[model samples]
Target chain A: MKQWMTLLNKELLEMTRNFKWIWVPIVFILIAVMEPITAYYMPQIIDSLGDLPDGAVIELPVPSAEEVLVASLSQYNTLGLLVIILSSMGIIAGERKSGVAGLILVKPVSYTAFVTAKWAGAMLLLWISYFIGYFVSWYYVGILFDTIPFIDFIQSFFIYGLWLSFVLTITVFFNSFLKSPGAVGFLSFAAVIVLIVISGTFSKWFEWSPAQLLSYASTFIMSGPISSDVWAAIILSVSGIIMLLGGSIAIFRRKELA
Target chain B: MSVVHVKNLKKNYQKHEVIKGIDFELMDKKCIALLGANGAGKTTTLQMLSGLMKPTNGEILFSGSREGDDFRHLIGYLPQHPVFYDWMTGREFLEYAGKLSGLSKKDSKKRTQELLELVGIEEAKNRRIGKYSGGMKQRLGIAQAIIHRPKLVILDEPVSALDPFGRREVLELMGRLKKETAILFSTHILNDAEEVCDEILFLHNGRLVESGTMEQLRDKHQQAKIDLEFKEDAARYADLFTALVKVQSHAIKRNKISFFVEDIELAKIGFLKVIAERNLPLVKFEISRTSLEEVFMKVVEK
Candidate 1:
């Protein structure tokens, strides 16, 4: 347990020194805050599109606060996912490449503790960054449009957080065995893309899939009381994360350091 | 006391064998050097002993420990090129290493300071490792390895990357450290292996070709010799020395003539007397112990 914390501290320290603590959240907040601001100013932006042929009358409907907020959240579906993956891609693999893993693994520390510490570190950053950007988005939605369902807002917060966690976990999972950070990112991005595409294509079948959790996140923003299928997707996503972490620890132990 | 006993250790990566069935014992509080050419499997053997890599077939028995025991805490390892997180301060990296080695929080901090001072990097403890020079980084690497004060400390080519001054600093530090703990280091530079190492193990082409104390290796492999310089090309006066003394053999190379003899004391006296009696112009005459390079050559050449 102590070894895990020491590693966790080291992991966070690396991110902090590189200003990852600042940029990762800023990226998420920008993606989160952009949708609401753009939606609120669309009419004026269109009007000011340089002499719009007098009475071009672009009849654009104003989206509801919940809709605008979900739009902001949807931005995370792609951009936020990428940010998480890209930021986390090198956490494990970089250590191995630079030979730091050899130093750390040679100690009395267990592989489970090492991998868990890394996962927990990334998860902490993910949660804090996601929460801060998300809170800012909520504040924006309240000011620009009607306030979103308060309780529903909280539920979707976790659902989306889990989805992002799913993405980060996948990246960390691949990094444990693979040596190249680029390859890890590519394979993880491919995995998430596959899930998104398959679930988007076969909604009825993949409703219990982890990808369904992302749609479920937006659903929680729109309404209350989710169906059993959404619950199934939630369980699957959580299980997938646990399994990935568990498998990463196992594979990490079997892999040689030098 | 033997710190660790390795028996018939062998490692194979698929079809290619790396360490072929070698046996050796590491004694407590002694410095041993693993001398080898690059690709002689020095690194592989050290890795296996450090528990970083498993031997495909062999037994590594730590003193008083059985199979399935968790003895990693008792071994400290520094790789050839240690990579530290650039952002971490010298003190932070050492403290982290200590904690990972199972030291308590208070103990880890205290040990970190002690190691920083011992490695002579205390003044730069606050500085990030990224800012350290090659020598300082190596000192830090050595510090981290012995943080837990393990029974055995394994270093792979500790000074091979440093400049001349850095190498001297590290070698001097190793000279101090050997008094407290057992150090097993690998180096291709025979001088390094000779300077600080009390025992030497030579790995040549994936086998334990030779290993012994410095004196034992020197006596067994080397024939004491006398070198003569006559101010001019000594090779021109080869016959004058051969007739003066019945050496086992005589050879001329460059400006000096060498008499290879089993008995260096008698050979030295005879050569000196012949030079004085003949009124020969002798600029230098000296009896020399065989260099580790010579012993290393004899072992690896085979």
Candidate 2:
């Protein structure tokens, strides 16, 4: 337990020093802030455009605060997730590649602690940045449109957080066996894309897959607990994260650190 | 004070075996040098011993250790090219390493401070490790390895890449560390091993070719040889010595003459008698023993 905490503290310190603390959050916040400003000014932006020709009229329906927040989430799914994957691509691979992991493991540290601490660190960085950005979106939506109910905001927020957790977990799992950080990033992106593609193509059969997390979160915001599939998805997603993290530990222990 | 007994320790990468069933003992508080050429399984053996790499088929038993024991606390390790969180200061890295070794926060701080002083890097402890020179990083590596007072410290070519000054500094530190803990370090340079280690294990092509103390190795591989330096060119005396009965072979270079003999004691008396009787100019004459280099060569070439 002490060794795990020690490594966890070291990981946090590394993040602080390596500029991850500053840049990761900045990227997420920028993505968060982009949605509301663009949503509110999109009509005016279209009005100012000369492409529509003189006195041309294009009817634009103003999206609700809940809808704005949901649209903001799409940005998170793309740009925000890209930042998370790229930033955390080297979390374990870098350490093992550079030979630092061998030094620590020779001490009284367990392989379980070593692998989990890395997962925990990446999770912490993900959630911290995500929440900070989510709160910004909340603030902007309150000012521009009708306020979302407190219960609705919190539920959707956690669900989106779970989705982010699932993505980071996939990245961590690939990181254990992959040599190149670049490959880890590519494969992580590929793995999520495959999951979502399969989920999208076979929606009826794969309704409870983690690929449905963003929609479940959106549903929670617009309405409350519409289907038992959301509950099943929540359970499966959390278990997926736990299982991947456990698998990473098992891989780290089994493979020679060379 | 503990002994590490490695029995038929083997490692295979894919199908080709890297460490071919090697066996050796790392005695209590004694420095053992794993001497071998590149790709000779020196690093692989050290890695297995450090618990960084698992052996394919072997039993590495630590004295007094029970089955399924978490004995890693008894060992510390440094790689050939150790990479750290370059952003961390020397002091911080040591403290972090100490804490990982299961020390309390306060104890970690205290031990880090002591190690910094002991390793003579106290002046630059606050500076980031990335800014440290090769020598400073090496000193820090040794300090971290022994911070927990482990029974064994495994170093994989700890000084192979350093300049002369850096090598001397690290060599001095290793010499001092032998009093506290057992050290297993790998080096291709025979002189460094001869100078620092109490015992040498010659690893060649993934096998334990030879293992013994320098004295024992020297005695076992010693030949009946004598080196004679002349006041002038020694070529004139070479043929005269080669013609003698005890002299098996002779070689001459510049002002020196080397004689390989069947009986050193008998040959020495015969050669000295001729030198005095013939009024020859003999500046230096001494019986020679096989050096560690020759022993290493014979072991590896075999």
Candidate 3:
């Protein structure tokens, strides 16, 4: 436990030194704030562009707070996920490539501790950035549209957070063996995209898939109630994260740090 | 007492075996040089001993520990090229290493400071490792390797990548470090093996071809040899020296010839008579014992 904490501190320090703490949250906030602002001013933006015919009456329906929040999540699902994946793709692979893994692994430290510390550090960053982005989007939704209930908002936030955690866990797992950060990011993103596509196309079959957590989150926010499948999806995603972490440690132990 | 004992240790990567069943023991409080040419499995052996790599077959017994026991805490290792977190300062990196080695917070900090001073990098303790010079980085590497005060420290070609000044600094530091804990370092440089090591383990083609105390190995393999340097072309004299009846073997390079002799006295007399009679352009002639380089070459060739 002590060793894990020490390694965790080191990982956090690395993140801070890399300015991940500053820029990641800044990007998240910017993406989140853009959602409601764009939705609220679409007519004005379109009017200022003068692309329509002269004196043409434009009928644009105002989106609800829930719809705005969902739109923000969809934006995060693309751009936000890309940023998170890119930032963390190098966490394990870079250390191994740089030969730092050999230096640390030679000590009495357990592989489990080393891997868990990395996961925890990435999760911490994810939570901070996700919450800040979600809450800021919620605040903008309240100003532009109707206010969402706090209970429903928090529940939706956690379910979406589970999806982010699952993505990061996959990144860490691939990073354990892959040498190139770009390859890890590309493969992991491809995996996530496939999961999202499968879940959307075959919702009846993948209702309990971990990928459904995002849809469940958006559903909970828009309707204030989730089906039994949401609970199943949460359980699956959480277990998947744990298994990925364990698999990373197991593979890392057998890997030759050359 | 031996700190580490290996019996027929072997590591095979697929069909090609890197370590072909080599065995040696590391004695307490002694510095052992693992001498080998490149591609000779020195790093592979060190990695297996440090628990970074697993041996395919054979046993590594740590002192007072069973076969399956975890002995990593009792050993410290420095790779050939030690990489660090560039964002971390020297002090923070050492502290992190110390903590990883099971040192407590206070103990880690204290040892970190002491090691910074011991390795002669106290002034750069707060400087990030990215800004450090090669010598300072090596010093920090050495400092981190011994921060836990393990029973044994393994260094893989510790000075092979450094400049002369940096090499001298690390060698001198290794001299001091051996007093506190046993050290097993691998180097291709025979002079480095001779300068600080008490014992030498020479590896060739994945086998322990020769190993003994520096004096013991020298005495065991020592041969009477003569070195002759000519002012003009020495190849001109190579044929005459090779024809001498007492000359067992001869190696020539540029303007110098080293002749290994069956009988030093007879060979010296005949060579001197030829030099006097012919008045060859001789610049230097000396009789001396065989050097470690010759022994290494002879062993590797065999």
Candidate 4:
């Protein structure tokens, strides 16, 4: 337990000292602030089509609370995806490439503790970033829509946490096996793309696929209760986390430092 | 008790056998130098002993309660080329290493400071390792290796990258470690093995060709050579020296001459008697011990 704490602290210190939090938070903030600002200006952007030579009449619908939530939530999802890729690339691959893993492995810490700490630390950073974005989106939604669902916002984040956990595991798995940050990112991005494709292409598993969670994050924010599909997505995503983590530990156990 | 025990260890990479059935025992509080040419399995042996790489066939046992799974924490290993996080400072690196080795956060921080001081890098502790010189990296490498104060320290060419001054300091620090810990270091440079090592393990072509105290190895394998300089021109009595029984080979360059003999004791005695009888003033003649380089060359040649 103490060893795990030391590793956790060391990991936390790394994130804090490296100014990683600065960029992480900024990225989320930009997305959060952009959501409502984009929503408030979106109609104006369409109205600017008045410059069309044909003078075509276009019907515009009033942006509802659901529309506002979806716009902000989708923007937040895109930003979260970027956060997962950027932050995770360094989590395990950086340690391995820098030769830091050898020193740590030689120590008294268990592999489980080391992997868990790394996974937890990365997830914690992303979680913080996600919530900051969540707060900003909520504040903007209140400004534009004149209403805020505080309890609903918190619950939506809880569900979003499950999806971020899935991203964290995939990052770790590739980080261990692949030593390059870019390669890990490329592989992870490809995996996410494939998951998205699979969910879209196969109607049967679409609801259960982990990819469904990212799209449904907006639904939760609009006072949509956590549905059976969300539960299935959580289960599937967590299962992927277990397999990836297990493979990482197994590969690390046999890796030759020299 | 031997802190490390390797019995008939073997490692093969594909069809090529890197370490062909080698064995060695490392007892507590003793430093052993593993000297060999490149590809002689010195690094491979060190890697296996540190448990970083598994051998194809062998039984490696650590002494006492510190054995098997728990044995890892008791061994400190410095690889030939240590890779460190470029972003982390030397102090942070050591703290990370210490924590991994099972030290508490408080203890790891304290030990990191102490190790930095020990390696004479306290001033540069805050500097990221990427900015360090070659020597500084090597020192930091050693610092991290010994942070836990393991029972056995395996340095795979630790000083190979350091400057002469840095090498000397690292050697001195290693020598100091001899009082408390056991070190098994591999080096292609025999001088390093000679300067600090208590014993030598010579490897040639993936086998343990020879191993002993420096003195024992010299006495066992060396063909004594005498640096002979006569009071008069030494070259004049070349035939006279060869005429004496016991001298197997003799070389004369200018006035100074050198002779090789199977038995240095016998040859020394005979040469002196000849000098006295000839009434030749002997300016200088001394039996020289075989240099570690000579020993290495001879072992590798065989």
Candidate 5:
């Protein structure tokens, strides 16, 4: 336990020194605030473009605050997910390639502790960045449109957080076996995209897949009290995170550090 | 007492074996040099011993226990090229290493401080490793390797990459380290092996070709040779020297010829007779024992 904490502290310090703490949250907040502000001023932005005929009657309906928040999530799903993947792609693969893993593994430290600390550190960064971004989106949505219920905001925040965790878990798992961080990022992104596509296309059949968490989060914002399907999705996603983490540790133990 | 014992250790990547089956024992409080040329499985052997690489087949017993034992706690290892988190200060890196070796917070800090001083890097303790010179990084590497005070510290070519000054500094440090704990260091440099090692293990083509104390190895491979340097026309004497029955083998470079002789006395008499008859312009002539470099080259070539 003590060794694990020591490694965890080291990982966190590495993150801080790399300025992940500063840049990641800043990027998240920028994306979150931009989504709602842009949605509210879409007509003005279009008018300023000046390509439309004079006195053109644009009859686009004002989107609800829930809709704006959901739009913000989609924005995060693309740009935010990209940021998370790019930042974390090197966590394990880079360490192994740089030979730092050999230095640490030679000590009395367990492979499980080393891997778990990395996962926890990545998860910590994900949680902090995602929550702060979500809150920023919430604040802007309330100002530009109707205020979302506090209970509804909290529920969606957790469900969305689960989706991010699932992605980060995949990043860590692939990083354990892959030598190149670029390949790890590519494969992880492909896997998540495939999951989202499959769950979307085969919704009835794959309703319990962790991929449903994204929709579950969106649904919680659009309405309230998600169905039993959401509970099943949450359980599946959490178990998936655990299984991936366990698999990472197993693979890392057997890996040969050159 | 032996701190580590290995029996028939082997490592294979796919069907290609890198480390053929070999065995050796490391005694407590002694320094052993693992001598091998590049690609001779020196690093592979060290990695397996350090628990960084799994041996394809073998038993590595630490203090007579092998089954279900965490022997890593009793061993510290420094790789050929030690990598560190560039963002970490020397002190922080040592603290991390100490903690990983199972030291408590206070104990780790104390040991980190002591090790910084011991490795002569106390002034650079707070500097980030990225900003450190190669020597400072190497000093820090040595400091981290011994922070836990393990029974045996394994250093893989510890000074192979350093400049002369850095090499001397680390060599001197290794001399002091052997007094506290057993050290098993690998190097291709024979002089390094001779300078500080109590026991030498010569590895060639993944096998333990020779191993003994300095005196034992010296006595075992001892051969008499005569070095002759001519002021001019040394090449003229080379053919004549090669034709002599007493000369077993000879190496010639520039104006000098080194003759490894079957009978030193006969070769000396024959050479003196040739010098008088041919009126060779000899600048220097001396008879001496063969060096470890010759022995190593002969062994590896075999």
Candidate 6:
């Protein structure tokens, strides 16, 4: 038990020192503050296009509460993906470069412990960032509209963070196998694109695609009722989390620390 | 009792055998220096002994057993090119290494400070390792290796990267470690080996060509040397000296005539008689003892 803690501590300390711990929270906060603020003011900026020409009845569609939720979520989700990739990119890939892996592998700790600790620590940091961002989003949206409640805001953002966790887990798994962070990041993004395209083509497989997980998150925040499809998406996201984490540990164990 | 015992050890990377069937024993608390040219299987041997790599055949016994897990508790290793996280301080690096060696948090902290002081890096202990000079980094590497008081420590070319002053300091630290642990290090620098090692294990062409105490190895290759400086026209007396023939071999270098002889006392006696017979001029005449450097070069070549 002590040995495992030592190994876990080493992993966490490494993450703290290497800029992972600090940047995740900063980026997530930026997303949180920027999301609702952008949503609240997007209308005025669009309307300031000035008076239309005489007889040119160009009527702009009214921005509703649904539009506010969707626009804010879209912006937040982009930053959320960035935080996920940035934090998970160096989990194992950096260890291989720094020769830190050599020091830990000689001890009694198994490869299982090494990978599991890396994933768990990274997940913890990501979750913390997501929560902070969610709180900021709720507060900022409330400042914009007095009627937005905190509990409803959390419920909407929780599913988005969970969906992002699945994507982050995949990034962590690829990080273990790939030689460079650039390669892992690029490959993971490419794989996500392919999955999105396939889901769009096959209606039956939409629930399994991680894209649905993200899309349904925005649907919930717009005050739309959670459907059977949303639950299915949640179940698929959980399954993905398991496969990614399990595959990472297995591949990492077989890899010889060169 | 031997601290390390390797029997029929073999390691292969696919088709090529890096470490062939090799066997050796290291005695307790003695500094053993491993000398081999690059690609002579020195690194591979150290890796297996430290449990960083498993042997493909045979066994490595620590305290008379092949238990890999507990065996590492008694072994500390420093690789030729060690890697460290760029952002961590020297103290953090050693503390982490100490913890991995099963030291408690308080003990790890205490030992980290002690080792930093021992290696003369106490002032730089809190600085990030990435910002350190190569010599400072090497000192940190040594500190971590000895932090846990391992019984057997293996360092691979530990001083090869340091400057002359840094080399001297590290070599001195290693000399001190000789009293506390059975130190085994590999280096191509013959002088470092001569200065710090009690026994030298000469590996050549993937085989143990010679292994013994420095004096023992020197004695095995001992040949008396006679250095004669001529007062007047030494070149003129070269033919005459070679012809007298008590010398095994003689090389003329400017004003000095260096002769390899079978017996120093016999050569002295013969030299005195020849000087009297020829009434030759003599500036200096002395017999030289064989140095460890000469023995190392000769044995390694064979």
Query: Mind giving the per-residue lDDT tens digits that candidate 5 earns over A1-258?
Result: 898999889989999999999999999899888989998999899888888888788988998898899988888888988899999999989988899888988888899998999999999998999889889989989988989998888988999889889999999999989989999999999998999899989999998988777788888898966678998899999999999999999998888876
lDDT of 1 by residue, A1-258 (tens): 778888888889888999999999999899999999999999888777777776566888889888888888788998999999999999989999999889988889898988888999999999999999998999998998888767878888998888889899999899999999999999999999999999999898888988878678877887856777988888898999999999998998889888
Top lDDT hit: 3
Please write out the lDDT profile of model 3 over residues A1-258, one tens digit for every residue.
999999999989899999999999999999988999999999999899997887899999988888999999888888988988998999999898888988988888888998899989999998999899889999989988889998888988999889988999999999988988889999999999999999989999999988788788888888856689888898899899999999999998888776
Residue B10 of candidate 1: its Cα lDDT? Answer: 98
In Å, residue A116's CA in model 5 sits off its true spot by: 1.1
Per-candidate TM vs. native? 0.95, 0.93, 0.95, 0.88, 0.95, 0.87
Q: Kindly list the interface RMSD, in angstroms, of each predicted candidate in the order they appear.
A: 1.0, 1.2, 1.0, 2.2, 1.0, 2.2
The alpha-carbon deviation from the true structure for residue A129 of candidate 6, after best TM-score superposition, in angstroms, is 1.4
Q: Tens digit of lDDT per residue, candidate 6, span B1-302? A: 68988888888999888877888889888999999888888988888787777788988888755555457678787888887777888988888888878789999999998898899999998888889998888888788788889889999899999999999999999999989899999998888998989998887766787888888887788688888888765777777766666777787877788788876777778777887898888888888866666676778776
Model 3: which residue pairs collide?
none
State how far residue B204 of model 6 sits from its true place (Å).
2.5
Score residue A254 of candidate 3 by CA lDDT: 81
Q: What is the TM-score of candidate 1? A: 0.95
TM-score of chain A of each: 0.97, 0.96, 0.97, 0.88, 0.97, 0.85
TM-score of 3: 0.95
Give the per-prediction TM-score of chain B.
0.92, 0.89, 0.93, 0.87, 0.93, 0.88
Residue by residue across A175-251, what tens digits does model 6's lDDT show? 87877877888877777667767876785767656667667776676666666788777778898889888888888
**What's the fnat for candidate 2, on a 0 to 1 scale?**
0.91
lDDT of 4 by residue, A143-258 (tens): 87756578777776777767777876887888777878889998887887787788878947588887777666767766666567777788878887888888888886667654
Using DockQ as the yardstick, the better of models 2 and 4 is 2
Q: lDDT by residue for model 5 over B26-110, one digit each (tens)? A: 9988999999889999999999899888899988889956654878888888888888999999999999899888999999999
Docking quality class, candidate 2: medium
Point out the worst 10-residue segment of candidate 2 chain A by lDDT. Answer: A48-57
